[model samples]
Target: MKFQLDEQQGGNAISRHDGQCVWVNGQPHRASLLVPWRGEVQPWPLSRFEDLTEAHFEQILACKPELVVFGSGARIRFARPQLYRSLIQARIGVETMDLGAACRTYNVLASEGRAVLAALLIDPE
Candidate 1:
């Protein structure tokens, strides 16, 4: 479940070494136990929010991921205090890293059969 990404046809594509699944951006090629983009892929999960708003909290709760990796596109940022607390309450671990690092982390964790969710944003230009 090591995922290698490719820039194909002007969009991002994901390829996994173990052939478990493939995704373009966050959309899975087939229905998977892991749901990508359960919410809007941009501001909600990918970015560091000011607070754990109801919608954001609900989305993460629904995912029930053992770990949630936030790819802040190109930088690392701390989560809002409320958001951090909510995740802790849900017994989920959180990692905030740059997009590339987040991607790598997600692949490794997913390969280990951990329920992992990633929110990555791609620079359009």
Candidate 2:
């Protein structure tokens, strides 16, 4: 599905549903669906992260965010150097932290209206 972002609500604004997956803007996202997102919980119908490709990164780049946060599941040092370099070359800052910290940081920056995109991974059970 197509995902449309609600720019006015900011990052704290998340769409939530009961059993159905949450859609961010209009596109189905699974960033928060795989776990309990404490902030603005939303339904993301997508099943896997592999579906998120370089095109997704390009779209996010359009946001002209100051920083991009990647939540690599529960691991602290699982960052993709190539992706990180790409963002840096575009003048965007990148941070690879655990999912929990990434969520908290994303909310804070999002609320502040900072251009920040969070690519969070699901915690393995």
Candidate 3:
């Protein structure tokens, strides 16, 4: 689906997304990636929800966002809390949803100037 956020001065926004890929700032990406509000976009190195691990969450922590909008491919899937205990203990919130929803919500939160990260996984298929 075509997704967009009001072009803010900084922060990455998803311009489009399909189950297999997402366009960040109009650049198409088939692999998982991390888009932090007002920061550089980086590869997340994940293809599916099952591939998630503590290391991935730690990577998100490195971005230092107040919240993470996790896009679990084309379906809504919740990661085990233990996978993100560090974020919880750090008081950073995580909201899990499908890629489409995450993209849309990320746009809204990001536009509001919230410190947010979009942890999106594109289906390997």
TM per candidate: 0.58, 0.55, 0.92
lDDT of 2 by residue, 1-125 (tens): 83444453633433432222334434555444421212333333333444545544555455566787766555565445554455668988777786567655665676666766665555332
Query: How far is 92's C-alpha from truth in model 1 (Å)?
Result: 0.6
**Deviation in Å, model 2, residue 113 alpha carbon:** 1.9
Task: Please give, for residues 67-86, the per-residue lDDT of candidate 1 as tens digits.
Answer: 87765444565656575576
Model 2: how far is 66 from its true place, Å? 1.6
Instruction: After the best TM-score superposition of candidate 3, give how far the Cα of residue 13 lies from its true spot, in angstroms.
Output: 1.2
Model 3 misplacement above 4 A: 1-6
Predicted candidate 3 versus true structure: per-residue lDDT over 4-101, tens digit per residue = 43576677788889888889888898899998988678999887678789999999998899999999888888999999999999999999999999
Q: How does each model score on lDDT? A: 0.52, 0.52, 0.88
Clashes of each: 0, 13, 1
- Total clashes, candidate 3? 1
Model 2, global lDDT: 0.52
